[model samples]
Target: MPETTGDWAPADFERHGHELLATLRQHFELIRDVPVARPYDAAELMGRLDTALPEQGEEFPRILTDTWENVVPDLVHWNHPAFHAYFSTCASFPGMLAETMTAALNVNSMLWKTSPSASALEQVVLRWIAELAGYPGDSDGLLVGGASLATLYALGAARDAALDYDVREEGMSGPHAKVARIYTSDQAHSSVDKAAITLGIGLRNVVKVPSDDRYGMRPDLLESAIARDVAAGYVPVAVVATVGTTSVAAADPLEPISEICRRLGVWLHVDAAYGGLFAFASRMGGEAEDVSVGDSLVVNPQKTLFVPLDSTALYCRRRGALANTYRLVPEYLTSVHTGGTFDFMDLSPQLGRGFRALKLWWVLRSFGRSGLRSRLDHAMELADRLRELAVGDPDWQCPAPSRYPLVCLRYAPRGGVGSGTDLDDLNARIVKELNDSGEAFVSHSVIRDGYVIRVSLANIHTTADDIERLWAALNHAAEKCR
Candidate 1:
């Protein structure tokens, strides 16, 4: 049948979808052939498709053709094997399928009454994630867009619990507003500061406690800070500890921090956005790090859990705190299904929660515990291999060892980081050369004030060969610069 300008038939939709699938099949199979991202300027792309809005409907095939020809080239292929930049996230086959299903279903999972299956599945999926993280399966939580919002929600609950006044009902504009303090390690994600700001806890009130030599938060220092704040008429609200910090993947000593928070009567929220799932990959038999030692904890599935973008689960041990902080039902949203089912809207500011549970459920189902472990173990091994390569090579150095699949390396050559060599610029140029090579893409970070190249190996498609190639490229760039 010819292309239709009118409403397309289901048969044609199916055919076009298959065509797109065939294209994606080749795209994935031959992903290595494509660049990680086109290093072209916006003007080049903007100059190409600068046409006005479409006046009439186009055929599905033409739309597909346009997408493949015009759109796919410019996007950064995070799924590419060599995309080791940032925390590599993989939208697995099952995850993509789940996305399609979710979009088609268009589930508004705010309340149990809205979509019973969505809410029920969310409860199950949240519990499954908590268990995987070695957290309490009985913990109450909700899926959020990302860990940032999760932190905000968790902090909101913490604020409500710590404050004697009803900050939610009575605005902080009153003279009764006192300096409420939120303490976190210097290396924690900026989400902590953001959450404090959003919660009317004030950015100035978020104390940045210093970390130890290994970059873990010093429990003594945190205790001292809280004590000092208390003496100064400040209320200790919460402590945001990190499982894996963004800059160097340094995890704050949660056990000690949790003890401090609990003893001091302060709420503890773990920002395990990057490294919490280390538990999910391998149940630590002898060397386990339990992240559930907090009032609330957040883990991002998009980070290492083979899910697509924008999916984070915030689990709170104090279910009442989360519900109390955000629960407010207008007459319109009043649901009679409150018998046993939870209205997820009461757990956070979100009135319309997507069927994000589907993404996690499908990904979890597709890759069972053993399969997930194998994939994460693969990434971990590759990271170790890269570090080993850096050690063996005379021109490179892996200075900061990460517990996760994050490796921080700097080109030091035979000598130290280089006497008058401007090491930072050299490393930055090396990263530029690697990214410009289009063979791979890796990011950079500063550890202990020294600039270093960061290779985050978590992609499902990445292999041992890719690591070697990236290492070789690093050396090649170093050689050219030296």
Candidate 2:
């Protein structure tokens, strides 16, 4: 075989690494001055990126230069302080350094034997996450790529626990297969529906419970839906209660929903991916007690904790449910220390896992609880400032009540009594104009037949000034559109 190793010499590695580090530092220093997103024509971007298979490898410096020149401009700079679209996150410096070290180590943390330190740190970090969320001390959790996968894993555990049939051994096609139903509020993320589809639960079986005035799930409606499904002879397998909804960040009434799930003997899964970190600040207060009733809960440190992307934890009270559903051991992969030690591969669908725990550990240790809480409180304050501005302005309407750093409002001229289509068109144009202007970025959502703008203040760099500038940009765009 030809020589396969491409390891860089020590001096060369250090030189290139320092150069890359400088690039990152410069990017962050000038991030606020850059546009939140730079729209590129699909064909033009493909022209720049589409290439023939090279028979030889290119120089590292050349590759890095090409990426900086061609790829960086097309990125949607989520780190920008003015990035108000969707949920925002900050890849903190400490987290970035941890990621670099993790890459250099390149450990596959699938099994304890594969990387003992990675496995132990993962366990510790997961416990820290559970404690931070005030979850039961006995709760067990593992990290996944993102909230979507985390939801999938949690639901897999729920599926096995809720059904009498062995889904792993016998499969869903067994004669005992029943229509498994999942219930979530209309405002829940689309990932819930996706998880159902992936788990062999038909999308048609996923029921959308109606939301109350504040966009939170109505407990009475949820109970009625469960009762209706049961009356139809369908098994209510799981109910996903969202603590922080995507559109308005409305938290569902967890206590009542949990009580209903308990009465119905259905699995309760809480999707607190976006709002769970607020637990640190105590902004959630007694509302978080709802998590106590959940069989499984998902929290993403990547969302608001200044960690790098793709660090999500799925905590399950029914730990055996996950292993029973996902664990499979062949003779080749067996180990001597298998009895008490956890092989993360047994709990997740992934067989080869990266050492993602280190970044979270670094971030958590760097910020500590007090530091993180302070940042979260600052975000909440900025959100409140935006809400106050919208509520005070006659031309702007705060349609939904925000429980977190997400604010949903509409720019409604003439007290919003105008034609629905006209208002929708206007707001849509305003969003497009704002994005095109490169001043700030905010997204839109439709609620109760009215289009509203959604602004999230989750970035650590975002401040009151950024929120004020976003308001000014929105008004300017609205004026131009009008």
Candidate 3:
């Protein structure tokens, strides 16, 4: 092929694109053979990366080679089959292709007029997600960067809806602002606190409702807290019910919590960042019944749906409330294309948005609902098997119930329960050893003053063999640490 006149000539583009794809293919093929997590000398790696500004452009191929040589080895492989750490993201190939195409187009779909197809596709994808999750047919949603942003946007709408005055126009400067409060489970994600802080609701006003033995929020305690706040002249603005907590993957009792919120007229936001997509796998103990009752819900495709990062959908039943909270039509952005057609900028915090819907659409299309359900079911089965293995072993104790794919277990020797060795210290040692072994990777979380290993199974490539290997690795590491 003849070279074009521009910087990236047609011939060069094709050659480099093929090289990138080939490199990715090779990496994926041998991913399982590499270390799940590896430690690198930070100073040495920094020496390779830290350099003076280049006077001129370097060869693209050399840059790619440097990335492979200097970066790939130091990464904690999240896509590795044995990566049983925090919720693993697979980034399926179809989704990757869609993302590449989206980048090539680089259309900002902030307004419908800016990119009509992108806006329409996003609306369609949002509806599909809501339908899959058993939300109301009338529910409306928008795609954001991730669950943190989604929660913030949802809480912002909730705050405005709860306030008697227009918070968007007047801000939270009035006397009434001092009395506003937000409620969430003690096990809720830190994003809830961040959202409250960003919204001018002091951290003191964020009440943490107690949890039961199973780690699910106690409805009785939540109701009492709300009542006490009301008696103290505090207006409860919103109640965030976590569907899948981070520590142990506990699903809060959403039905009772939603009922209490409804009676109290408090905005209910369900944070299902880790477990919401399980709605499609209802047979494997996934439930969306409680989620259906909430005023708003947030689910992350990036976490569980095999999509790449930054694809979170926030569904709001009260669409008017969201529009009223975030709608800002500046003179420069005014358009005659009105009614029924949505300008996404009106419903989100960002005025310039990428074409995130393309990747989500591709993921859903490639893996139909049944395919996704099958993958989720497989992960649940793996968790069950792991729990069985831990229970069968006398040295291991399963601390929490395996409601989802995340399994929490701790190392407790036969005679070391009340021995001199601190259980937390021993478990920490075991985790460190396991991570350092370069065979498999797992994370740790503290529950009830005890450190427990958190092994999450969400990567599509993980199999029974991988779990068995992890089981062996855990036993070996525990013995070595002991």
Candidate 4:
């Protein structure tokens, strides 16, 4: 049969989709092949396509072609092998396919009755992730957007468990007004503070536990802080131990942190957003580190497992605590509930959740455990190589050991580039030069009051050649420094 000319027909859509996919792939190829380009010129883009909204509509093929020409080129390709900036993952094709299918189905997995498969899949996938993270066999967990929400949920559980008030039902009313305090390493992600603020816990109550030389939170400091808080009539509710710190991938002493929490009778939550997956690939028994030391664990498969974004697993040792914190079943919503069913509504804050688990399920089955392990192993190996390269050169300094697939190094000009204002300006210029050149993309962070450049090797496609290109770009950027 001839192709239908109008509306959205299956065959017609598929044909156009294939063409669009090719165009998308072509844009990615350009990013991989020519990693560097001048900034997008506004006037140049204005000449390529329409500026105003269409009154009626245009052909799908024309839209695709125009998008390829005008839109795709402007995007910074996070999937590019050389995109070593920030915490990122180049998601596998299987993950992309799963996302497409789930969006097409558009299942809302609020409860078992709402979408049985999605609810069940999320439960099964969360359990699988928890096992990989080394959570105890008795633990239960749920899928959340990412670490931010995971922390919020864990903190919510802390509030509920410690105060003996069902805040979800009680509506933060009569009881549960105790001054709650949470602790995390000074180097921990800023999400903890944000979560506390949203929870109505004062930001001042989020104590920054000092770190040891390795940058991990100091157990001694933590204990002293807890002791002081308890003495001052404040409830030491929760302590967040970071598995992989955002700045340098530093790991807190989990065993010690857990012990401190236990003695203080406080809840322990491990924020391993960046580094928890290494627990599985690390000599510690792949994914097992996530479960070993906390009442709750937050792991982002999206960051390290090549899964797409918005895939995070929150594993909790105390299932009752999670349900008690978030469960809310109105009479109308409970009508579909039959006893002994797994309803996700009891564990998550969302009433209408997407089928996010399908993507991870597909990726896990497609790659298998061994395949995923190999990818992680390769990333760490490449990171070690980069670390060695940086440290060997007198022009650069690897200030800290990169325990995982992330390294932070700073370029130093020989004979002293400048002093005072000039020194800071030189480092600033170096960072801009490297990013603008795009031979490699490196992120910047402030450590001990000095700016440093960071490179993360989390992509499966990253190669030794890519590492070499990063070094070359660093040298070039250093030369550009005043």
For this target, which candidate reaches the highest lDDT against the unseen true structure?
3
Superposed by TM-score, candidate 4 places the C-alpha of residue 424 at a distance from the truth, in angstroms, of 3.9
The weakest ten consecutive residues by lDDT in model 2 span 282-291
Off by over 4 Å in 2: 1-5, 285-289, 415-421
Off by over 4 Å in 4: 1-7, 28-31, 34-50, 169-176, 282-290, 335-339, 419-423
Deviation in Å, model 3, residue 326 alpha carbon: 0.9
Candidate 1 structure quality by residue, lDDT tens digits, 1-482: 44445556788768877998898999988988898876778998998778789766666778788888998888888888899888777788999989988988899998899889999999899888888788998888899999999999999888888988888778666656767889999888888888888878888999999998888899999999999999999999899999888877888888888988889899999999988887756523335457879899999989998999889999999968888978899999998865588799999998998999998999999989789888988888898899888888777778758768889998876665556678888899888888877888889988775899988988988889888888787788777776
Alpha-carbon lDDT of model 2: 0.85
State the lDDT of candidate 3 residue by residue for 148-241, as single tens digits.
Answer: 9999999999888888876777788965554689999999999999998898988998999999999999999999999998998887999998
How accurate locally is residue 317 in candidate 3, as Cα lDDT from 0 to 100?
94
RMSD to the true structure for each prediction, in A, is 2.0, 2.4, 2.1, 3.0
Q: Residues 234-351, candidate 2, lDDT per residue (tens digit)?
A: 8888999998898888888888999898888999999999877687675655455456678999988999889998799988897677888888988877866855687888887889
lDDT tens digits by residue: candidate 4, 44-71: 7676654778666677887777775667
The C-alpha stretches of model 3 lying farther than 4 A from their native spots are 1-6, 285-289, 417-420
Clashes of each: 0, 0, 0, 7
The models' CA-based lDDT, in order, is 0.86, 0.85, 0.87, 0.80
Q: Candidates' TM-scores?
A: 0.96, 0.95, 0.96, 0.92
- In candidate 2 the C-alpha lDDT for residue 251 amounts to 86
